[model samples]
Target chain A: AQSVTQPDIHITVSEGASLELRCNYSYGATPYLFWYVQSPGQGLQLLLKYFSGDTLVQGIKGFEAEFKRSQSSFNLRKPSVHWSDAAEYFCAVGHFNKFYFGSGTKLNVKP
Target chain B: DTAVSQTPKYLVTQMGNDKSIKCEQNLGHDTMYWYKQDSKKFLKIMFSYNNKELIINETVPNRFSPKSPDKAHLNLHINSLELGDSAVYFCASSQRTSGSIGEQFFGPGTRLTVL
Candidate 1:
């Protein structure tokens, strides 16, 4: 079965530090990969997505993700973490019209 | 303007009661979906409608029924709601085509509490 995995359940990062969230997926073909963020009392927002061409895709809020086919990974990265960046992040893989989401990772930023 | 919107931001109801949550999208997307976020915060897709046609239905119970009145509206109705049904339900929309795939736009979720 196709699934997405976010190994870390919770992560804490100091303000202004670099941040990386890992995601791995299992699928037969090259899949449409995406990263979504959900803040407190808010809906999920699309951060970035990878379709066909470039491995590295830049998204809103200064977030980026790279899709590595070899490892079946699409990891999200940010250069400097902001206090407002503390939220829940979910990685999803899209096949046809359905999306398989990973158990989200919660980020806590220390001021 | 909100791209996707769901009515009743918060709902508190008793068990064995029937309730419905309405969702609408103004993004002109053809596909609309309903997802359930459990206490563990794991989001699982429940149902999806494409152009008023049921396309994807997960292993959800028969008590859960979805209605699509039009291309822009999708409603979820739950029968005999159980305590386990207390969770946040989200509605999302996307534009799917042969040439390009669109990112889903989510609505401010409706937090349902079955007491």
Candidate 2:
């Protein structure tokens, strides 16, 4: 019933270029959405979350995401790509203390 | 200090062997959870406990058993390990109150390798 989809399996971008990772969710009610980044062989770190209020949410490591209720999408964006930003990104939807995660998108940055 | 900690960052064992992974959270949260991450990095929730009471249990193999000694400690024991059991296991905690399931804090994760 509730699910998350990250369409991009892999993305590559040159340094200083803009980056966008797409995500979409399927839920009955307003979803508690989150973005997490996982480095190679590391645990996931929370990037940001969208609960209520302003649609644009800022996160650590210079990442930001916007929640669009009409489209059921919460896409992550970055003004400039960094070499260190190359990692796996996941989008999750939480409800009643449970989370539904997407397949994840792997980002590759070329210097 | 680590907010959530798991013992044995890496484990390697043969098939049919029994092993256990211990997890502890010092964040004083009310809820704890265990998640399994496959080689493809797909995270699936295994079990969850709130104040030592089982609250959520996903469709996991019976070979996997979770025990909570107290509110802060949760241990996962697996019997008769198989190659398919080899994956990274993560323990996370969150403070859920008044129907608000807040953000989760995860441990470093334990990488298990079964031969």
Candidate 3:
């Protein structure tokens, strides 16, 4: 069974600090990787995606994710955290016509 | 213009009632999907329709039926809605081509509250 796991259920970072959210997936082959952010009472917005080529992918709102095949991990990172960045982050793996999403990681930005 | 849109942004209904959530995408994608987000904010894929054809159906209750009238529209109907069904439902669309299903465009979710 292919599945996605986000070990960190919640993370807190101070404003202007670096942030990293971990994600791991179990798949037979390299799969499409994605990162999405959802704010309170709002729809999810795609942050970045990794299909092929360039292992490093940049996404909207100053977010970037790197796909490491050996580790079977796609971790999301940001240089500096903003108060506005406080939200739920989800890591997803896409295969064929379906997608498997991780439970989610909630980020709380402190002042 | 919204690429993907869902009707009834907020729905408050009683248990055992049947309701439908409509979805439409103008991005010209051939694949559409239905996702459910629980109160814990866990997102799960429910169904996927490509060009009005069912392609993927996850482990969901039979009470949850999805209808795709056309490539651009996918609707989800729930029968005997239970309190456990209260959650946010999202509609999404993507293009599947050459073994690459790109990123999905999501609509503003419909928050369903069954009492």
Best by DockQ: 3
lDDT per residue (tens digit) for residues A1-111 in model 3:
889999999999999999999999999987988999999988988999998999999998899999999999999999999999999999999999888899999999999
Stretches of candidate 3 above 4 Å error? none
- Cα lDDT tens digits, model 1, A47-111, are 99988899999999999999999999999999999999999999999888889999999999999
Candidate 3 per-residue lDDT over residues B56-113, each given as its tens digit: 8999999999999999999999999999999999999999989668899899999999
Task: Evaluate all candidate structures by whole-model CA lDDT and list the values in order.
Answer: 0.95, 0.94, 0.94
Q: State the lDDT of candidate 2 residue by residue for B12-105, as single tens digits.
A: 9999999999999999998999999999999999999999999989999999999999999999999999999999999999989678678888
Candidate order by decreasing DockQ: 3, 2, 1
CAPRI-style docking class of model 2 based on DockQ:
medium
- Residue A7, candidate 1: Cα error in Å is 0.3
Runs of candidate 2 with Cα error greater than 4 angstroms are none
The two-chain DockQ for each candidate, comma-separated, is 0.66, 0.75, 0.78
Q: Candidate 1 lDDT, tens digit per residue, B26-110? A: 9999999999999899999999999899999999999999999999999999999999999999999999978335688899999
Which residue pairs come into collision in candidate 1?
A: none
Output DockQ, candidate 1. 0.66
